[model samples]
Target: MAATEPAGSRHRNEAGPVGDQVRANLKFFRARQGISTTQLARLLEALGRPILATAITKIESGDRKVDVGDLVALALALRTTPNRMLLPDYGPSRGQADVALTPTVTVFPDLAWAWASGKQQLLAAEIALGHGEESPFEVLEEFRRNALTTAERQHADHTAVRAAEAVLSSIRGILDRIDNPVRYDVEDESRARHPDSAARLGPAPATPEGLRARLRSLIAEIDALIGDDSDG
Candidate 1:
């Protein structure tokens, strides 16, 4: 591996408890299902935006910290848990901890669930910013004007748009990911997703273009409620 690679790429390095688990489980499923990164990314795209091969590589290698959202997506992707990824036998742990662990145990679903819930919170927050009257779109215009007039204050519309786009793209990506159907039990959908996300689970379109149209529709409804033509 190259020195430029992240900590996860180094073979000489030891994997902490969670990292080890992710590596093991991803390897297990990828080989078992014979799924390629392109296929997996397609699945991810179905779930939201397009994930690159490198992103998948970083994730599988435990280079990136697997948050709850990542774990949920991974589990949904490979059909396993965060704990199972860390180590095959790891059950859910007792509390929210950030530390080292023994190599023997993997990850717990509860821990993964906690992490996933955190991810959902973040998504919800981003969605909240973009939704209804909170149109980051409208906010951007005001902020930009203020920033330009104020000393050293940037309006941050770019930042806001990026954030909103991320939320929107992720929603699109989730749409792409689920279409492939790794292990989407109705039970899992109800248990694992936010109410809004769960509702969107049924009968997602086959293409991103179609999903974008629906997103536009949702945005239009928001536009009406806010009665503002300019979102940003």
Candidate 2:
């Protein structure tokens, strides 16, 4: 459970600067929900807190101080979390320590899922390759599929996605060309002897470096997908 702060430390809800952010958040949420002060007051009353419509007006207009319980209650009535009602609007604070504001990183749900799935597929591919059970082309295909899914969901950069799609098409063509190539040829025997050493072997058709390059391209595409949800 979260430890509660002292009452005195709470945002002083008067007109100057103390509770400006909370007031703005409250007004924005209320107006966005099309809930008038009277309706909100009735909703709060239904929640067992009998606040008047005048009090709701004063609270939203930054003319009245809001208690901790009232803040939580108002947030619940607005159908939002308390933290959402308390987010700072990137404005100046009172005479306190100089605090630098940094951009908060947030991950999109679809991209996050694709990232986790890609990692699992990569680990499985590595294990399968070590056991000489699955073709490397099949692993690359899975990587391409994951990248395509993320690209479709990420509406940030269309050009990067198009390039990746073209590259994937080329890779699919190459994969189809050698769909049933012999796995244990004389050349492969020579390459297998130096399996542990990536340097001694020249660039083979299915070198790990080639796979790493594909992974890097996919990651670059994902990086280009950086933006906030509001942009959509």
Candidate 3:
């Protein structure tokens, strides 16, 4: 009788296209950032979850599997969003290629990307007709059941706007600190000296200008959604 392969070895032998895409993108992003495996491992450690350089190499080479936690950590360490790491890197022109989301599931790159980015839901017939192709009776009913009331939607819009504004404020604060470190240090010292006089601050912002642009885009998107719902 043949000897059994180790349980951990299953991923290496059974890895599919989705795994392949992830591995390729992992290597691509790491290289794009000019980060070595050792550097990436250190970054992950700084993020509070340590992954050895050898394991990272295995993950990149399709010899290891990446769990959800690792995926998030890798994305953070690489300064990218999780969806960007999960999706395939279609070239500049983004040629019409079918992306395999699962062993039995494949979709056009656009649909796959949209679904991954929370822009659209994956439907049974989407592979054939593309997203928002038709609103069938069941789908319409499902939407109706889960649809937000007008007041609720307006409240959500306001909440989103407020959140975006908060993030923008945080980003501006970070930029200010970077541009005027001496003044920021003095302010920090003052704040430390007088706890009661210190102003509360939001969480640290991600990727400064890029994040600001994304927040603007998200606010615009929320406005568009509200407009579309109102029209409907």
Candidate 4:
């Protein structure tokens, strides 16, 4: 029989800083869902790893060492990605954390939800400033203004910051396309068919007689081409 790794050494990481982030996220998410330690343990057990309530308390209190397998299990039970549990760099870091507030973790779901909501608002703003609409430029200006206001002082969370950036980036693209339209030369069939004749005529005839002469010459040229084709 193979000897199993010691119980304490089974899943512990050499660098224990990862444990702090995981424990924090696990406690925070679990509390938000109003799940008791017993309930969480049962959920983890149901996910193919049996966990006892005491084990959960020890993990949260930093008494027990949490391993990679345990982190994956906890993340699954909490319905969040493992990165959210382990990575503390998901949000902007402000120097070193003090003892007052729990550091905010910018989970992926929150960012996704904020982006979807901002997209809907941007769509409405686009309709308000669409082509041929009254005061369309003003509408875009007002939208940009409101977004700036929100970005500057409205909120402090990472989701809020990312959402604001998304709106501004989208608005800038729309404005750029509007300002720089594609240009093309007007297609002139007369110029294409008879460049030499057009040059000789010198800027087209303004008078009725000149117009009639031009038309007659064009008709004669067409007739000659048709005659040659029939002969051939």
Alpha carbon deviation, residue 46, candidate 1 (Å): 1.3
Query: lDDT (0-100) at residue 9 of candidate 2?
Result: 93
Residue range 92-143, candidate 4, lDDT tens digits: 2223232211122222332322323332223333444464454655654554
TM-score of 2: 0.34
- Candidate 2 C-alpha lDDT tens digits along 1-232: 9999988898843344336657888889988999999999998999887789998898876667777888888889999876556553322222223211112222322223333444224443255347455576776566656654665446323666655654564464346336424532555677677776634543453444554565566667666677444557
Per-candidate clashes come to: 31, 0, 0, 0
- How accurate locally, in lDDT, is each candidate? 0.55, 0.59, 0.70, 0.57
Q: 162 in model 2: Cα distance from truth in Å?
A: 33
**Which pairs of residues collide in model 4?**
none
The candidate maximizing lDDT is 3
Between candidates 1 and 3, the lDDT winner: 3
Off by over 4 Å in 4: 1-15, 89-232
Error of 2 at 83 (Å): 0.7
User: What TM-score does model 1 achieve against the real structure?
Assistant: 0.32
Higher-scoring candidate on lDDT, 1 or 2: 2
What candidate 3 gets wrong by more than 4 Å, as runs, is 1-13, 91-94, 124-232
Per-residue accuracy of model 1 over 14-112 as CA lDDT, tens digit each: 556657657667767888999887788788677665567778888777775555666667777777665556544422233324323344322334334
Candidate 4 weakest ten by summed lDDT: 98-107
lDDT measured at residue 116 in model 1 versus the true structure, 0 to 100:
40
lDDT of 1: 0.55
Which model, 1 or 2, shows the larger TM-score?
2
Clashing residue pairs for model 3:
none
